[model samples]
Target: MSRRPPARRRPARRPRRPRQQQEHLVGLLLAAAAALWLMATVVHWLLAHWWILLAAAVIAVLGGIGWWQQRVQRAQWEHAQARALRYGLPQLDALSHRQFEYTVRDLMYRDGCTDAVQVGGQGDLGADVKATDPHGRRWVIQCKHRRHGEQGAAVGTPELQVLNGTGRPVHKADVVVMVTNGRITQPGRDFARQQRLHLVDRQLLASWAAGSRPLWELLPALPPPRKPSRLS
Candidate 1:
């Protein structure tokens, strides 16, 4: 009797929604949001004085700008910190990088170098540092200082080669300073001298490292080379 009683009736399926319905719903939602935002803005304006609205707008713009700059500076600092740490410069690595960078800069400063970029570029055709001396002379400074002796100061021709190649591409570059803590290879030095490159030798650098001749002490007017203590 149950089997034959009747085929159980299935509930009717709901009609499928049309694609345009979703689009319509989205449009409606956006319109509602815009209206709500407008209403809120109007209410804020009515409740506050005109000056208050102006002040709030200015504050918002300033806050946004400040936040952006902080983000950029933090990113730069983090990258620099990471690079320093990777190279055995600890949390204090920034200080060390700055110290050595300052030393390279000191040469320019001693000789009246101005408007220097501490660390120059990262992407295609970038230099380690870029600076302009007081005389409107442009200097490309390369700083090479390794904790181990293997990475000493003494830029080779390859680096010079890179600079030489890149320099021609730049219209402003006038001088290239391949700075290093180690002595330059004879070939490199010979090439530099022959190429009219300026040399900042290791003996002179030792004076800075030893603190007997801090960069601040040197001026464009420094006297001729004088014997100083040896650097181990």
Candidate 2:
């Protein structure tokens, strides 16, 4: 057998600087000599010349605010859940309107959503909560905290229509979910099925709240089963 030629040696690559360190060094070097002594000036220059840096700072502040709010809201939700558990999940009916919305938001976060923000109340246009999943799919949820009583109030097609209309281009949602603590009318279910809307009823909500089921198990995005082929 012929001897194999020696393999060519590859050149060593330089170690790459971390993006943050490089940015800091550039900012410092670009600072005016008079202001070089002040680190604040370098920061200011970075903010002025690099809009991305400024945007990142704004996003960071907003994220911090959101995290703080989520923490507070989660604490409040846990407290409410504790109270509800005392009398069973049915006690969820006792939550006030705002409290109910917060509870839903908290659950959405627990369901693996990247972020969930309450946008309920007047002028909400049907969406009570806006959630973004890990895949960046946006979801608009409407919470109907109907009392579980004999009056038997039911969520209907009208509410579903309103949500479907507003959740699209307006809220930029990939899906719209209507969560009710009451039964849904037949027409409501029909309309939702036709429109591909996700309707979470009382029993489902109770199960989720009680931690018996995870959100993925109740995922509403699953496609309907295909009909059997007549040829078969």
Instruction: For candidate 2, write residues 1-232 as lDDT tens digits.
Output: 9999999999997667787799988887777654755777778888678988878899999999999999999988865654453223556687776878888887777655547899999999999999875555677999888765324589999989999899886897776889877789999999999988888888777777777343546766643323332211
Candidate-wise lDDT, in order:
0.57, 0.76
Summing lDDT over every window of 10 consecutive residues in candidate 2, give the lowest-scoring window.
223-232
- Candidate 1: minimum summed lDDT over ten consecutive residues — where? 85-94
How well does candidate 2 match the true structure in TM-score terms? 0.57
RMSD of every prediction: 12.0, 22.2
> At residue 112, what lDDT does model 2 achieve?
52
Tens-place lDDT digits, model 1, residues 81-133: 43332212221123344466665654444333446556643653536667665
Evaluate model 1: give its lDDT: 0.57
TM-score of every model? 0.43, 0.57
